[model samples]
Target: MPIVDLGSIRGPEGPQGARGLPGLTAVPTDQGLADYIRAGKDSKTGQALDLAPLLDKPTILSNSRRVYTINNGPWGAALGAVRDGIRDARILVVSDSTGQGVGGSSMDSFPQRTSWPSFLAQLMDDLVVPTAHGLGIPKSNSSAQPYDTRWTLGAGWAAGATYVGFGGKQTNYVAAPGSGALVYNDPRVYANTYDIYYAVSNNATYGQLTAVATGGGTNTVQTGSQSVREIRKMTVVAGSASGNNVVQITNSGSAGNVTIVGIEPRLSSQKKVIVGNASVSGSTTSDWVAYHDNTVTNGWNAFSYMSAYQPDLVIIDLGINDAIPSAQASVETYTANIRQLITAAESAGASVVLKSMIPSVAARAAREAQYVAALDSLRYPFVDLFNRYGSYEKTSAEGWMADDVHGNDRIYQDEGRYMLQALIMSPMSLAAKSVTIPALPALPVEGWSERWRADQIPLTVGSDVRAFMSVARTALKPESTWTPPTLAIGDGGRKVVRFNGTTDGLSLAATRTQPHTVVVLGRLRAISTAANNGIVGAGQSAGSRSSLFVSTDGKLVINAGVSLTNPAAVPTTTQVFIGVFNGNNSVAGLTGADTAGAAGSEGATAMYVGRLGNTGMAQLDVEEIIIYPRGLSSAERTSLTAALAALAK
Candidate 1:
């Protein structure tokens, strides 16, 4: 092989070497790479790429094959799942406050602590994403708790969610903390980042019930239910006296013995009550006996026997009893309960409205302050009834309430009105109009007989029309019984008018000559032989026998002249009438006849220009009924009539 130095050869570029077979362009592999990544399997190299990046892309799979490709696929799926979970989430509120006073006295505290859970439930109802269920754990420390739980859970299970007890067995089946049995334990619960647990102080008289949470070897108390997992805040507070005002029954009073029990998250689930004593009185043993009797007979629990019916909003009105003592513990219990109620409702996906406790007396303003502080501290929306209706001092005299605690019907109605206004004004409310109609043009001429038809006024050979006319006539005698003349005229190449009636003794007359509309008038005459009977002077006898007819095509007009030869010969009481009729036989007529010897009449007579029959008729005259393609004004009618008379000549 001879090795020629290429640099030396150079052979004039050798004719571009046939273009080097067009360099093969690189095709995009990103699309293919994307597909492989979406396949969710290891690559040919047996190593799987981190799909986290691909998680940014969403893959739509159909028939086991990838279809649509979306960015951030995994994250989107996670978010969607979260949203759906939130939509289906529910919350259960448990209140353990019992009704009691600081001085061992029974009080009319129902559902002890104002039933804050119920109020919270009502608020939740207004939320965009409503709760699947709102179950109240009633009086977890009372005997009713177990029975209520069993009944409520039984219903809940049938509807789809489980029930979990919060406290011990007597009042509730204490489940392991954070177990799946608890609503919080369910991963779906986190669909929303928030959860709420509600508990209340059982006794406002002796010592307020405080939420206890396990913290590094000891129990701790928190202000709001949002802080701990198992521990929740008290939403409602109630109070009653226990023992001496100074030496209270710390934990044994009706208000002191509070607990929380089971709850169901199923749709339409009812509240469940738990164990607790009723407000006590007299000896401690006697009070305990009465509490037991009440629980056994009436199924009384920690709170009152109240239960919810899945209300959209709940209202809590409590703290009056707690404020009586002016004790810090009582106030704390009230505040804690409110906080818990709010949390539970939010967890359940509901909005809440707390009501401020009304004061009982002017001096009780201090108590009201404590109550207001407790409510405000919760940071939930609230309705201040005390402020709305004048304070106790102003409304108390007016009898706003029947008792010191419960409002009367009037007050309740007022409350209802407020609620209604709030609901309607809220963005979530809806309303609609009842009826509507399109507007139409108003017509002129009231009380005038009207008829509508396809107009043939243009009088074309084929056009149809409906004519409506009114005429009034007076008693008139024709000079002779004669038929009107009919004629035809041509306007350029078009057939303008074609009259087809008789014209024996008829005469054409126009009051004006220069381009005037001619009105044809007929003279009526009665034939009689006897001297006085002959043509009895244009009276009813003559008027009834005459008629005028014309075309609505603006080409014709008719006027009938009636007369009575002797005005005294006809009965003075004799009356005459006139009428006009349209093509459709629709008629309008006048009541009085043209008086005899009128200027237009040759002798004594009466005549009128009016509509004919109420609806149907043809032979009639329409007065002032100008006839011209272009409507004639008063001057034009006069001018046109003159012109026609001249043309007739």
Candidate 2:
């Protein structure tokens, strides 16, 4: 049988090779397999093997499930690497002088730059706190109140005429000759000795004044004669054992209406703020910027010292001082400044954490609430210190503040603990959550292969011509003078290329005579105010070819066979998107203008950017440019316009 069978006697394909290993229910392609592996574990079994035991610490899953191996080293080496990373962690503390002991003394244990950095250093290593002292920003000493006292009634009340409360009308407190005149009893005053501010309205009576507080004899904090409407601040005594201090104001010479507008304990000089040094606190430095009457002025971004420090997290504890009546900063202005700060900070590669302004004194309670409300609406990592200790009423009752503007040690400690948690813990990864990417409009299943990104192109510093990607691969050839890629401006730290109008331009190799779409993200230079500033063009001259330019009226114009108008103006400072689609029948353009066009023919030879051949030289800055072989659909055009608009912002 063996001799007879041989190679000539083969069976009929052996039942199709036994069905080829069950036909793989799902195909594992590059994308498919990656997604599957990311899902982890066998779906049917619903179980996962502990690969760490077989491999090592920080194990990574291989491409194939069947392949598994141990790491090159032991777990100790991996842990050492992690420790090094932890040691190199950079932490930045941005706060008022409270973090640097401006008005108050620093805590002895952590007496240095900022107490937060020192405390965090004690817990972990590699913490870097930047020195904010040299930022050249102003500082304030007088505490910032959260409310605007200007909203209260009797704003111009006489100096001697008393007001019942912050919202009260004019009232008179006339004292009998030689009899002590009693003012309102305030619980916030210090039991030992504290400062009291009285807003007197037109005090014309000249008299010998004697001030008294609970559980203390009369002490003359100030002497007033022939007083006008003025704010008189004096140190007075208080009642013993947390009792309300009955403040008495007596004028021996004559009886007159004396008014006490507001009274609260002033921020003490001994109040401890920041505490740490650069050496023991892991290169952290706290600058004392908290001064009297410091508003949210400019120069916040320009940190003089430690300019090289990149903050991992930026804490902004401002606006309380800015909300004061004297500061005169509106909530809108303060919020705008804060937004700018956040953008700048985030742009500098740091996460921002906005701290809510704490409760202010009773006089500015309403204003503080508005400021806090503004902060609450902003989109960022936020810490509600105002709510943490207790809200305005509770804070006032619990005595969590050294003064109306700054918090005591208890508040600072609690805040530091929360901050430490945010720093140490992993912020929930965006990857862990399901991502929903809006699907792009599918290309017409036809020709549209030409693609070019200006940012991706290669160019030399002094080269006359640079090559770019396109259906007709064009190169930028500057004729005489050109500004190279230096000016950069964009959100998210994206940079764009700039070109001078007179001489800077791109030269194309061959004529592109097919129906094509051109997309550009660009902005006009400040100096270029000409009516016909070319953005992207493809032809020997401006009028004879396909091109998009800013017309004399500042609106975008497309000259592709026929001229089409884009309703939006080209912004000089901000970037804009200009798209031109020369279709089979008609040529059109868009600037997020979404304009329609009538049917027309098209003619274009060589391509040019920043200038229309040699005539319409343009001083323009371009961020990105794309040229497709075929015209784009309405959906694709709209989507691209919107996407580019977001980038411009």
For each candidate, the alpha-carbon lDDT, in order, equals 0.26, 0.42
Candidate 2 local lDDT, residue 417: 39
RMSD of 2: 27.5
- For residues 222-325, write the lDDT of model 2, one tens digit per residue: 22442122334456655553434455566544544343433333222222111111111100111112110111121111121111232334566665546557
What is every candidate's alpha-carbon RMSD to the true fold? Answer: 38.5, 27.5
Please write out the lDDT profile of model 1 over residues 1-649, one tens digit for every residue. Answer: 1111111111111111121211112221334323433443332224322332323322211122111111012112222222344222222222122121111111233222222232222222221113222333322333321222112221111111111122122333221122222221111111111112323222232112232111212122332221111223222111221111110011222222222332222321221111112221111111112232212112122111211111222344445544544443356555655554433332221334455554556555576676776565554444455555546665567665544544443344344333322322221111121011112122221222221111111112321111111111101111122222111122222211221122122111112211111122121122122212111111233333223322222111222243122111222111111222122221211111111222121111232122111111122211122222121233433444444333223
Model 1 residue 591 distance off true place after TM-score fit, in angstroms: 99
Q: Any runs in candidate 1 off by more than 4 Å, and if so which?
A: 1-133, 140-260, 268-318, 326-354, 370-380, 393-402, 408-424, 427-649
In candidate 2, what residue range of length 10 has the lowest lDDT sum?
1-10
Candidate 2 C-alpha error for residue 607, in Å: 29
